[model samples]
Target: MKMIVGKGSCGIAAGANKVSDSAEQYIKDNNLDIDVSVTGCIGMCYLEPIVDFIRDDGTKTTYVLVNAENIKEIIDSELKGETLTKYEMPEVDKQRLEKQTRIALRNCGVINPEHIEEYIAKGGYKAIEKCVTEMTPEEVIEEIKVSGLAGRGGAGFPTWFKWNAARSAQGTKKYTICNADEGDPGAFMDRAVLEGDPHAVLEGMLIGAYAMGSDEGVIYVRAEYPLAIVRLNIAIKQAEEKGFLGDNIFGSNFSFRIRIKAGAGAFVCGEETALIASLEGERGMPRLKPPFPANKGYWQKPSNINNVETYANVAWIILNGGKAFSAMGTPNSKGTKVFALTGKIKKGGLVEIPMGATVKDVIFDIGGGIKEDRAFKAVQMGGPSGGCIPADLVDTLIDYKTLAATGAIMGSGGMVVMDETTCMVDMARFFLDFTCKESCGKCIHCRLGTKRMLEILTRITDGEGKDGDIELLESLALNIKSSALCGLGQTAPNPVLTTIRYFRNEYEDHIYKKKCTAHQCKNLVSYTIDADKCKGCTLCARNCPVGAISGTVKNPHVIDTDKCIKCGKCLSSCNFGAVIVD
Candidate 1:
């Protein structure tokens, strides 16, 4: 029998390492023959620190939220051939896993990532071997073209087209790069893949290198993902020792070598040219289009770059045949896409679903809807650069064309669900603030225009907005979208434009009525005591941080708005429902 503990970043954060150590110590002390190992996250992060016990017959039982305290009891129960129902995975989480199709993340939580043999047992590097031995580079490219796999990074461009471009381009020193610099605020699809199954990405990159006639590969990952980098370094070394990488791979003429380049966490470097520029030891910034990366990339040679998720799909498409992958999703978007489901969500973690599933399907069925059973208001897709889709559009299909039609791009698949309590105006301001700060300051339109828009948004949220502030913001957004040199500036105005398009009423309330309907903007929120409900128990008065509440015991209390500071302490501290926010 074997016991596997989750050790991904999320699992580690939840104290899975302590659980693993305790279980190992127990096995050592008891002289048990059970083997203990670790695996990456299983996408059901809500029930993290998950422990799995595999019997000799291959039957596996999963236990959620396992800690050092109860791990011994669970192991003891398993040894006695008895099931502990309390520690077992919940039925709702099981349903969450059953509803979706997982392709890119197939082996993520199933195998031990640090072990090369485990990855190989699951057919790890076979796709690259097949590519080098049986088929030519053209055949491999044709297979990918048939699969209809687009770039999962954000652009949704055809992957085969980029490979073909680099293959046919005039350059002996070509390159195949993996864009692991995932910088979207709520996005971690790439990071999870890199941490959980680094081999899948490496094998995919190896296949890409073979098809593009490139012997050199580089994974440009952000420095923030230290765990992923460490695991990747381990995978690279293992692959080299096993001949899956390096010269004369599979005993063929095609040879490839891969190295890692740690990025400085610049959001703009997600763009290809900017990433290449950063790799060239220059300031991370985007360049003009005539000499696109396909023709002139990374040291001015012909190069092909695809993000981590895009590369993760390569081996699958190669093995299962492209037609199988194209069988899923809408006509435009093929196969499944991974999304980081976060914000006011009950099951906040990695979610991979087929392309055509509705937002309702993901949020309601898989995500278990909004937290605290609050009214779902909006979901921000594509991070700071992507726009918001209001509650009315919850049924919108998840696809390239469908989401784009809703003013939101399927940008790296970040679904930030918002509830009714979230102020749309302030939410827009928050995203605009992120983009404004992340701007590389290359273009006057992005640098200055976003600054101006942010100022107007700040004024609106602070209750100093005027009637024409919305119009001014719209005009500036259009200008920046048209004039900005890169995707960063062009899409920076998305959150603002989308908020105005869907929730213009919220903007008007903040600007014209001088009120924040959701009571989220502190400058506009006011606290008052309900005269009838106030028991004057002194709890509110004593808990008030600034001595804002006043009254004797057993009498009606009053809130001094001047001293309240809008902290809402009295509201929470009051046992009775006396405090009201307006």
Candidate 2:
């Protein structure tokens, strides 16, 4: 029997470690012969610490919201072949399962991440084995081409084209780089894959290295992801020990080695050129693109860079053949895309859905709808550099072409769902603020343009927006999108542009009426006392942090408008529902 505990970052955050320890203790205390192991996330983040119990008969039952307290009962019931219906998370319909295809995330939440043998046992390096033994370098590229696997790392560029370009390049020292430097604010899909299935990514890299005839592979990982780094280091050491890495891998004449290059948490480092510069021990910044990475990259040699998720998919495509993988998703965009569905959504975690799945299905069906049963407003896909998609367009198919056509890019798949309480103007301003700080300052449009746009958004959120502020924002967004050099700057205006396209009325209301429809912009709200319901409750007066409320023991409380800071402390303290924000 197999009893697995979720060990992803979200699971860890929800006390999965304690759950694991408790399960182990319970097993030992009960003298059970069950196998208790740790795995990655199962995407249901709302019911984290997800425990999966697989019986000897291969029937599996998943227990959601599993905590330390429930460990003993789960072990006794599930491990002992007893069913605990009370602990099981209700299974969704078959359509939801059919909509998802787990190619990149196949091994995730299935194997113990720290153990290399566990990964190997589950057909981990079969692709590299097939490639080294039977397939030639060009044949491997052709398989990827047939698979129609584009880069999952935001750009959606053809993966085989990148490999073929590097393979065709006239260079003695070509390079293969695994871009683990995922800098998107709400995106942890790459980090999860790296942490959970490092060997899968390494196997993909090995395949790429063999395909492109590259001898050296570098993993450009961000310093912030310590767990991923640790797991990656472990996987590298294990692979080298097993002769999967190092010279003449798998007895093949093709010699390859992989090294780790730590990034200093720079968002620009995710770009190919900037990642190359950082790997070269220089400051992370983007350069010109005409002489692209394929021709001249990474110490002026031919290089191919793909993000963690993209490389993770390579091994599967090689093993399963192209047609098997290509038949899953949309015609233009093939295969499953992993999204870190977060922000205001009920089930916020890693979700791997097929490319053609609509945004509505992702949000409502898989995500279990919005938190607190709030009305759906919009979803911000692609993180800070992405755009806001309105609730009306929820049925829009989520693919690279569809999102791009809607003036948004399928950025690293950070789907941040926003409810009715989220202010569109505030959302735009928040993302702009993030980008302004993360700007590499390589281009003036990204640096100054983002700052200016952030200022306008800030003014609008603060109720100081003028009639022309919206027009100014639109103009600046277009200029930035067109004039910027790198992707950071090029897509920096996405939030503003998409918000203006979808929630223009909210912007107009803020600019013209000086009111926040969502009541999110604190500056536009005023706290007042409803005299009829005050009941002379001095509790509000005493609890007022700013001393803005004053009243006698029996008389109705009144707020001194001039002195009130609109903090709403008295409102929360009042039991009679006297305080109101208008």
Candidate 3:
């Protein structure tokens, strides 16, 4: 029997290392002939610290939420040829990975990432082999065009369109760049791919370099992802030694090499021009794009740039054939998309579903619905640069056109779920604050405009808003979208604009009534004691950080409104649910 422990960032954070160490010790202590190994996250983050037990018969059983304490019992049961049913993954979570069409994440969590042989066993670099040996560069571009794969980084630009442009561009020196600097909040799809299946991304980059006629490539990944960088550096070295990368790859006339450039985690650098500027050692800011990267980029040479997910799908399209991928999704958006499911979701992890699947299908069927069974309020799509999609539109199809119609683009695939207790006005404020701080100050419209919008949102949530504030926000949003220098500033007002479009009443309530309906904004919330439910436990008083709650023993507790600070500790501490917020 062989045991493998998940060691991705999520797994490590959830104590998978401790579980692995204990399992290893138990195996050594018992003198068992079982093999122990490690791998990356398989997108089931909620069931993390996962342990996979494989029998000699080739059957694999996954144990979820494993820790140091419970691993010995599992090891003992396995040695005795007994089934440990309690540690097995739930049927619902089992269905999670089984349900999605995994092209990019095909090798993720299934193979040992540190070893290139495991990746090669899964037919990893065959795409580049086929591209160099079987098909021509133009033929590869044609295949991508037939596949209908777009830029998965939010903008739905055709993959082949950019490749062909860069290939045909009038430049002696050309470059291929992978935009792995994913800055969207709550988004970790790229990080997972890098940490779990770095070779797949490298293989995709290899094929892209061959297709784009580039001799050099750069993966501009974020510095925040230490594991991803470490794994990537390892993958590159392995690929180099295997001849899948570096001079005369696969013994062909073609030669391509890739380098890693660590970014400082700037949000504005997500834009191609700004990324190009950063690559040139300038401040990460956007420049006017008449010579869009294809014609002139990266040190003023012709370059092609795509996000990690977009390139990760390349080898799959090459192997599976373009028509096979194009048949899966709706008319416009083809193939599958990966989303980092987060916030109030039950199965909060990485989800890859077909493009046409309804939001309800992802959130309910796959995600297992909201946490604590709370009433669904809205989903913040596309990060701060995206919009809030309300519960009424949960059935909206997960396509670029459909999501864009609701004022939210299918961004880098960060789906933040919100419950009924979430204050939409305050939520808008929070996102605006992100965009405001992240602004690069390159263009006056984006620099001053987003700051002004954030100030307005702050005032509204702070109970100091006026009647024309909504109109003022709308006007600013429209102008910024039109006049801003780049995509970041243009899309900065998405949270504010979409909230006004769908949930204007929430903003109005914050301004006109000075009452937070969800009781989320601390400035607008009032804590009170419910006489009927309070048992004078003094638990609330003891837990209060500000000493807000006080009362006699065996009597109902009272919350001092002035000293309350509007913290909800009292509400959670009371066993009878005596504390109330209004």
Candidate 4:
């Protein structure tokens, strides 16, 4: 029997390491003929610490939420050839797995990410071998073009177009870069890929380097992703040992090598120009395009840049043939896209779907709807740079053109689900605040305009907004979008713009009525004592940090509205349902 524990970052955080330790110790002590190993995340994060037991007959049993103690029990059951239904993976999770079209995540939860043998057994380096051995660079480029795979890193630029440009560029030297610097606020698709399936990403880069006739590759991953960095280092060393990364790989004249460049966690570096600038040891800021990376990138040599997800799709496309992938999504956008599900979501984790799938299917069917079964209000797609898609557009087909039409770009697939209690105005404010701080200050319009817009949003949320603030925000957003030097500043106001477009009433309520309908903005809400429900055990008064509640002992306490900070301490402390927020 073989026991594999999901030991990606999420799995480790959920105690997969402990489970693995216990399972290994148990197997050793009992002298069982079982091998224990680890794999990366499967995107089923909610059922983390997932343990997969493969019997000698090749049947597999998946156990969810396994810990040190329960894992021993599960191992004992496996030894006895008995099934433990209690720890079995739920049907809903199985359905979720069956629902995803998984291309990038194909080997994530299945293979040992650190083992080359396991990866090769699953057809790991075949794509690069096919590229270097079977097909010419031009043939490889044509195959990618036929597959119609665009850059999965938000811009949706043709992957083949970039490679061809780099391939055709008249330069003595060329380079290939994987933009693993995934800095989106709630996105982790890249991190998961890097951690769970490092070799796949490396293989993709190898093929890209070969296609572009480059001898060097670099993975510009975020330093915050220590696990990914560690794993990438390990994978590179492993590939080098196997003669896959060094000079003349697979007996072909093509020679390529990859090194890691850990980024300083700048969100702006997600942009290609900015990433290149950072790679050159400069400020992570964007420069004017037209040199366009392919023409002159990375020390002014021809370069091809694709994000982690984009490169991840390469091996699959090459092996399966481009037409096989192009057969999937819409005309403009082809193949499956991976998204990070977060914020007020029940089944919050990684989500992968074909281009034509609707938002409804992901958020409701796959995501298991909102947390606590709350009313789904809006989904903040694309992170701070993306927009807040309202519930009305839940059925919107999740294609590049379609999502763009909704005022949100499918930015590297960050789908933050929001519930009814989420204040749209505050949500916009929150995203704006992130952009304002993250602004590299390269462009005057973005630096000052976003700050100005943020100030107005702050005023609106604080119940201090005046007339024309809305108009002022819209005007600033337009100017910033038109004049900002980079994609970061250009799309900084997207959340604000989308909220104003779809939930203008919420803005008006905060500005005109001095009320937040969702009651999220503390400055616009106050706590009051409900006389009918107050038992007055002095708990409210004792808990009020600012002495906001005052009354005789055993009498119905009243809240001093002027003194209240809207902290809701009294509300939580009161045994009786006395404190009310309004």
Question: Which candidate has the top score in TM-score?
Answer: 1
Q: What is the TM-score of candidate 1?
A: 0.99
Give lDDT tens digits, candidate 3, residues 39-136: 98799899999999888888788899999989999888876777699988988788788899898888788898998998889998888898999999
Off by over 4 Å in 1: none
lDDT string for model 1 (399-468, tens) is 9999999999999999999998999999899988999999999999999999999999999999999978
User: Which residues of candidate 2, in runs, are more than 4 Å off?
Assistant: 26-32, 56-58, 93-99, 553-555, 575-577
Distance from true location, Cα of 474 in model 2, Å: 2.0
Model 3 has a clash total of 0
TM agreement with the true structure for every prediction: 0.99, 0.95, 0.98, 0.98
Which 10 consecutive residues of model 3 have the lowest summed lDDT? 74-83
Model 4: worst 10 consecutive residues (lDDT sum): 571-580
Better of 1 and 3 by TM-score: 1
* Global lDDT scores for all candidate models: 0.93, 0.87, 0.90, 0.91
- The residue pairs in collision within model 1 are none
